[model samples]
Target: MRHATTSDGVRIAYQIEGQGPPLVLLSGQANDHHWWDGVRNDFHSAHSTLTLDYRGTGESDKPDQPYSTAGFAQDVIAVLDELGIDRADIYGTSMGGRVAQHLAARYPDRVGALVLGCTSPGGTHGIERDNEVRKSLAQPQPAARQALLELMYTPAWLATHQGPYNTLGDPDMPAYAKRRHLAASNQHDAWDILPDIAAPTLVLHGTDDRFNPAANAPLLAQRIPFASMHLIPGARHAYFEEFRAIASPLALDFLATARQR
Candidate 1:
């Protein structure tokens, strides 16, 4: 992994894989680069992948302060700039999708394409999670993590695969950092600004996602000019992890199409 310093003097950790056109992968709240472990390598076969740990997670700095999606967008650019890459396609999940929205909107030259999964546009129009999910996700406790798994995965999938869920006994990020990440995530708002995003966009979501409802997909596709939406039947927030084969290929096709345009 390599390091890049943000304008605020915070260090960001990033890793690269494969050998082709650049593709940057952004993680959701409280997750590090490990979030992409499921499908990153598959995409890496055709594209060079860049994965990063957002400021408060993974191997990056965790400040005992507030966070914003806007600030995360800057850290993304710092990574690209450090690597000497002019532009790249972006894949953002959950909270990271908010950052991707900002990247395509505010730093148009830096982002050529975007893929948003299990995320919202924020504000009143977007679909927000219910109270149960909110309370469970407020802190990364063991019970909360189990509840999260239930919310993030369908029963059938869980029955077939419990390895990932069983291994998730401890919180990956510290309790303080988890709270800070969640705080920043809850404040994410790109409602009015989503339309300003000019990059080609693809919105992937799960039909049964309790964390971020699937209804948000149509709203994002409707708002973003060059956007398409796909919903995975009976899947949840961690749709990519569950439907890696389909979702990954679909994402690659979306990005490949963007490059030709």
Candidate 2:
């Protein structure tokens, strides 16, 4: 485990595995560094994979306040500075993808390549929740938690992982954990800035991503000057899990090509 202090004095936690060129994994809402457990080993074999717990999640310090994609981007930059890395290939999922887009646009020199998964371009495509889903998100914690679980995972996944989902009620999590999670969920929106990204990008989305429609993938790819799009078949919002076999190869190929460029 490693730690870096952001410009705002927030302590960010991260872990480095394997070796070679640097590759950073940025997770989505309600997730932390451990979210990459399934694919970390594969990524480690080809590059130095750095997985970090964003400020308000995982083992990192959590401060009570609003969270923004801009703040998260700074946290990532701070980590890179602490490690003396000039540039890195970045992979972000959902909300993390928004951060990556902002970083590539705001600090072009720091990004070697970019990959966005299951994310949207903001505006009409980003975070525009259905009325029912929006209402559920506005509810209090107990009810909100149930709504989140249903929305985040498919019925098939829930059927198999019921025990793990049920354990969320263990009551040991810090109050701020839930607070920050919800805060992030409600506050995140970066659709207005997608065009500023210039780094070579690869956008991956599942064909059946009910959370964020698959159309957003093309919308993003079309906006980024040098972006490519890949649609994973038979996958949902959790495309990484369903298309790991294909997605990993595609990611490695894109990173390799981007590095050479």
Candidate 2 all-Cα RMSD: 3.1
Counted clashes in each candidate structure: 0, 2
- List ranges where model 2 is wrong by over 4 Å: 124-127, 132-173
What's the lDDT for residue 40 in model 2?
77
* Per-residue lDDT of model 2, residues 1-261, tens digit only: 889999888999999999999999888765677777767787876799998887777678888877777788999999999999999999998877877888888888999899999887675555454687778767998898777666656677777765443212223436776676656645655566667777899999988676667878988898888999999976776677546798888999999998888
Candidate 2, run of 10 with poorest lDDT: 164-173
Please give, for residues 19-101, the per-residue lDDT of candidate 1 as tens digits. 99999998887778877776778897779999888888778887777788889999999999999999999999888898898
Whole-model lDDT values for every prediction? 0.85, 0.79
